[model samples]
Target: MFQETVQVLERLLRSPSQIAKHCAADEDPRALFLASLCATLLGAAAFGGVLATSRGGLQLLYSATKVPLALVITLVLVVPALHGLAASLGQPLRLSAVVSLVLAATGRAALVLLALSPVVWLALDRGIGYHSSVLLAAACYALAGLSALGLLWHGVGKSLRGAFVIACFGLVLVPTGAQTAWLLRPFIGRPAQARVPFLRHRESSFADAMYLSALSSQGIYRAPEPNSHPAPRGATNLADDAEEAP
Candidate 1:
């Protein structure tokens, strides 16, 4: 089992074409799905826990659980859209095949995230400010997303229509994934937070939070709204709602 898992991870990073063919043929799909699912859950959980190291305590557990949950939910929501998009673009794939392909791509991304976990943890440990930490995490996510896109591109086919389909899928994916993660925010709790909450009340959209984070990272914070609650000492002063992970 360990050897097989290692082989799958290696193929995910180094031989996406072969993995794509396996998914397209639906060969031993149950085994493929199980392996990819395990990779996704474990990798995402590890990275999430690392992200929470900035704000230790129950946050490690909360972030670890929520990150995998977010990924699973995002996959559930987007797989059908990917199937439909591929079909519409004349790259029709069996729904099961599509599912396996997507799971593999996401698992690949999770592995990338896991690889980045230590770097992010080190940055947080070095006392990077909250806004900079958020930006750093976002950068790591973008890098992982790119890794996933490579596998997905191969799975769909390296042709023109496949490129179009993947592009369309990405458009749907970015916002959906972002909103899902945003809805389950506080992955990196404020360092000065009195108590860690499993979730935060939805204030702004993911796009808004990211935009604000970018500005805050540059030391240009948004003014607080009238009658808005004050932010915690170590939180970004973005309308009293600190931007969380992307």
Candidate 2:
């Protein structure tokens, strides 16, 4: 069995096109379409929960705003990773810094559009507190800008560009995962919230964690729920919500 597996692996790696074709056999176009739909529903649920209370909005605003902040934060975290990746791909170490910075700037611009536009629309539609809206708006813009930076880097950072792109995505995904964990922790019956530095306050209490999780009457939180409720006024919950291109 082991020898057979090794032989298959060797053959797969030798022909990239063959590997692609083989994997494509597992592709489910209909499932992908349905999954996309399901993703939209999930996002809407998350948005709806954020809209429930001013406190929740404030918390979400604080968190979502970190998207841009993460760009800067992750850049610091990701630079070394990107540098190494670039070098592996045959890029010059000497020029990596300039390339990384330029890419970051472009990503930031895209982030602003993704995060701020919906924030503005929501503030108008829901009559969110002005101070809250502005604060959220500013944070949203920051995220959009950073995402814009990432998109730029993805396109322009050539050698090890794939690695650079992966790193940027990691920068976005890491914080997102962290934030989701923070929000979900409280609702999962944890008794306390752990504070993370540099973004905003952590849940501070287990009960304070993701309110929507607690709010769910169903075992799981579904945006539209099976019963079907409207999503938040402005958020579609897509990456486009907070990670659009410039």
Candidate 3:
């Protein structure tokens, strides 16, 4: 199993275009699906290890869950949209193929994330600060996503009614992913906190989180003070620290 997995990984990483092309040619979509799924899960695990540094082992487990949840959320939202578009455009609309292609694309993104893990580890270890780390992680994810889109286009554009639908799906996918990740917050540990929580309060919108991160990074925003007492488990507290010199 290990050897076969290695071979699959090598092929996908070395020739993602070829693997994508083969998958598009109907060479066992399930194989591609499994390969991509494993790749994504493994990549997420590596990221989880990095998060373990500041967030603790419990949060590391939570971090591992992010990509899978994000993947499911994005696919659930984007797949139907793509299917409907394909149907309306009189495209063949092979649902399985589309799904496999998407998986491959995202898996490639995960591979990129794996490659980026070292850099992220360095940033986290060297103390790049909360907002900068968030921005960096977001930028890496965005780059990976764009690369994935390009791979998807290369793999399946020949069959689609142009690649316009792929772009359209991206419009929905990006926000869906961000919101989902927001809902599953604290992937990276907060400065003043220790224990991780599940299903915390939704005090702010996703836009607010990103904006505050940016503002706080620039020293323009003053986050309210944390209570002297310990925060309860499952409580959400994302307020930035005013004392830390950014």
Tens digits of per-residue lDDT for model 2 on 30-81?
3322322232233323332333233342445443444334333434554565
Q: What lDDT tens digits, residue by residue, belong to model 3 across residues 119-209?
A: 9888888988877877777877787788777766665554455487667767777877787776666677665675567545454556656
Clashing pairs for model 3 are none
How many backbone clashes can be found in candidate 2? 29
Q: Assess candidate 1 and give its lDDT.
A: 0.83
Candidate 2 residue-wise lDDT at 17: 36
lDDT tens string, model 1, 125-222?
Answer: 99998888888888888888888878889999999988899899999988988888888988888879899999887565677668777887887878
TM-score of each: 0.92, 0.35, 0.82
Error of 2 at 153 (Å): 4.0
For lDDT, the strongest prediction is: 1
Q: What Cα-based lDDT does every candidate model obtain? A: 0.83, 0.36, 0.66
Clashes of each: 0, 29, 0
Off by over 4 Å in 3: 1-5, 89-91, 158-161, 222-246
